[model samples]
Target: MTGTRSVRPGIRFAAAGFILAVLLSAPRAEPPPLTLAILPLKLLDTSGEPIDQGPEHARRLAAMARGLAEDLDAGGDYRSLLVTAETLRARCPDERPDCLLAVAREAGASRVFVGVVHKSSTLILQLFARVADARTGRAVLTRDLNFRGDTDEAWRRAGVFLAGQIREAGP
Candidate 1:
């Protein structure tokens, strides 16, 4: 009777361990590896036309992509092949990878990111971003990022938001 009572807790613990082991051993899904192309950071004028090329905005976009890659690398979870703003500006539009498959092959990336900037209302600036898979030519993620700033602040916010999205977004 004494041994039976004492073994009950041990049996319970064993059952719990078995449950935990099964849970841990269960198969987990994974995101695939791919290259990401970032288009030039276009700053639309007050008239809603792309007229200004804010150096700061351009730099921010490039930095944002790089930062996202860096953060992912630190965790050792995924890899990002990011192209710089300078390359986008330097290349001809026809030569650039605005399309997914084209972007992936040209930029040597598996995915592509195309973004547009629009000044919404008076206080908010909208950064419309889209992610496309180069292999499948499908949009994986779509997000409208907003920033509160005139010039420098806008890019800064864009950078931060891009980083956050990448962290929250898998692969």
Candidate 2:
């Protein structure tokens, strides 16, 4: 009887340990990524000089916004969507937080990313970007980058840097 009791306890301990090991080794399911609406980046040229708002500039802006979305989406943290300037203006006339949040909600996004490129001159540009919670109108991430040169490559690199910052700041 004594030997049987000792063996029973050993079996129970082994069974418990095996169950714990299996549970610990099981793959955990990650939660779905949050939906994010990336609004068209606005240009605020404060250079006090006429810089051509030509097709090239427009193309660069569009590409920058698209690249940001793609970069964020690739990180598996956010399901990024694009919202055009016209759409945002039509939906929310004001730039207030509440208005922005309403626009984000309408786009079925839990968060919104907005940015403005401030051009001091043809050689200098300052980019300000922020991510805000649509529900609370609270900013989750904000970053500003100043880069030299007005070339496509410079703008593209700036977007990449901003995206890396956002990824590090996770949703």
Candidate 3:
């Protein structure tokens, strides 16, 4: 009978309050960066003999990381590049493992990716994919994931896992 639809004042007020709360609590998203450089990888295999400083180990890890970076680009709308360990060591002969960061900075990358390979019969893999500020070496984000498989397939699963993370993270 009233001019407006008949509803209790408290009910109307509660509905309005809920609407306001939802508006305030909704998530906001931003686009990811446009370019990323995938730096090289190191093998940390523990066994009767070490795999470090060997072409077989180092080249495989580097190729796998590059593959990952390319896969990430598919979902991220980003540019992917390989920053080779040879080029890095050429610039800084006294290269510690972390010196790869400097090369990424040189490549004009906003984000740098790094990984370490751990090999075993079951292939316990620990991959450190960190996005860092190229200049200061400050880590912006990191994904630490593990995989158990034959060594090569472990690389593929880990790559898929990383690509999903990059996509979900919005670049």
Each prediction's total of clashing residue pairs, residues at least 3 apart in sequence or on different chains, is 2, 0, 0
Could you estimate the TM-score for every candidate?
A: 0.59, 0.87, 0.68
Candidate 3 C-alpha lDDT tens digits along 1-171: 573555667689999999999998998675755677777777776544543436665656866886787787676577777877678778767765467666776787777766666664445657777777666778767888788764566677787887778767765
C-alpha lDDT score of every prediction, in listed order: 0.64, 0.88, 0.70
Reference-based lDDT, residue 107, model 1? 63
Where in model 1 is the C-alpha error above 4 Å?
1-33, 47-53, 84-92, 95-100, 120-122, 151-154
Best by TM-score: 2
Q: What's the true lDDT of residue 95 in model 1?
A: 51
Q: Where is model 3 more than 4 Å wrong at Cα?
A: 1-33, 49-56, 96-99
State the lDDT of candidate 1 residue by residue for 1-171, as single tens digits: 999999999999999999999999999776655456555455564644355545655665556556656665565544556665455445555554443356456767766666677765446677787777877767888888777765665666676676567657756
lDDT of candidate 2 over 43-113, digit per residue (tens): 88777766566677789889999999999999999899898878878877787778878888987999999
Q: Rank the candidates by TM-score, best first.
A: 2, 3, 1
What lDDT, from 0 to 1, does candidate 3 have? 0.70
Rank order (by lDDT, best first): 2, 3, 1
Q: Model 1: what TM-score? A: 0.59
Flag the better candidate by TM-score, 1 or 3. 3
User: Which residues of candidate 2, in runs, are more than 4 Å off?
Assistant: 1-7
Distance (Å) between predicted and true CA of 81, model 2? 1.2
